[model samples]
Target: MRLKETEPEEIKLNMTAMIDIVFQLLVFFIMTFKVVAMEGDFNIRMPLASQNQEESMDEDFPTIIYVQLAAGTNGNINSIIVDDDTTFSDTDMYSKLTQLVESKIAAEGNPEDSKETEVEFDIARELKYSYTVKAIEAVSGKVVDGQIKKLIQKIKFKDSTSF
Candidate 1:
């Protein structure tokens, strides 16, 4: 008998299948995955309308301002915030926001423009929903909804916070 060779055969891994799976998984995630913000304390119980409608409606518009409302420790809406720190209330709130809106319109250099941008509100979740609506209505003569068409001409209910 011939002398036996002790060398072992080399093993190889087929990466093409693994690479194809990885690429497939990547594409699958790209199609299925979505990125969204987490509104931890901020929440709203938006009611679902029973009326079935087309999905393409209200798809192109962009909102302007964002208003955040939270319940103060005293159980009253002691402050109204913008973005985060821009807080105001009473006359101050009205004046500041009004000025901000006015300035925004002015920035476009349109003196006779009646179009209003959106004002998203993050209000105290515990407060009666009417209270929040009333606050904005008191200012814009309407409630914030998509397009701000009714009372709030350019408003959107951004979110609400429990605290």
Candidate 2:
């Protein structure tokens, strides 16, 4: 019996199409990428609750100013109230808020008071987000002679459902 010998054929995969697909995917992802701006810089410090009630009720405790942002029917800021007394509903609400915050800081009679002061924002659920941000900016700080003068460093948000 006679046997026939056969040679094995080399198998070559066409990688050009695979490389093209990889480049296309890279280009698509690059084109669809988006850049977003940075968020606001806020410094907040919350200490643990005191076990002693007397210490919590101390007279030297840090001052907490409440800011109430009431919204109108149109979701616009109707009034900006500070401590349930001072209210600003004029067109320049933000400026008034900034001034009030600044005055409060100055009234402490010490430059170090700004760090100890805290602002609690009680914003209406219907208020526009922009208005809330403006109010925050007003109390956060102000630009003085091209320099930023930091005001109250601590900020907190109250329960909206309570309003």
Top candidate when judged by TM-score against the true structure? 2
Which sections of candidate 2 miss by over 4 Å? 1-30, 33-35, 43-59, 159-163
Candidate 2 global lDDT: 0.83
User: By summed lDDT, which 10 consecutive residues of candidate 2 come out lowest?
Assistant: 44-53
Window of ten residues with lowest summed lDDT in model 1:
47-56
CA RMSD, predictions in order: 18.4, 7.0
lDDT of 2 by residue, 1-163 (tens): 8988889889999999999999999999999999989876555555544533355587566788899999998998899999999999999989999999888888988967688787889989989999988888899888999998888777778842211
Enumerate residue pairs that collide in model 1. 43-160, 67-120, 69-122, 142-151, 142-152, 148-153
| TM-score result, candidate 1 | 0.44
lDDT of 1 by residue, 1-163 (tens): 9998889978998899999999999999999998988743222333333221232154445335667666756556666677665777674565465555556555756534434345667667676664575556544532246453232354545432211
Tell how far residue 114 is off in model 1, in angstroms: 5.0
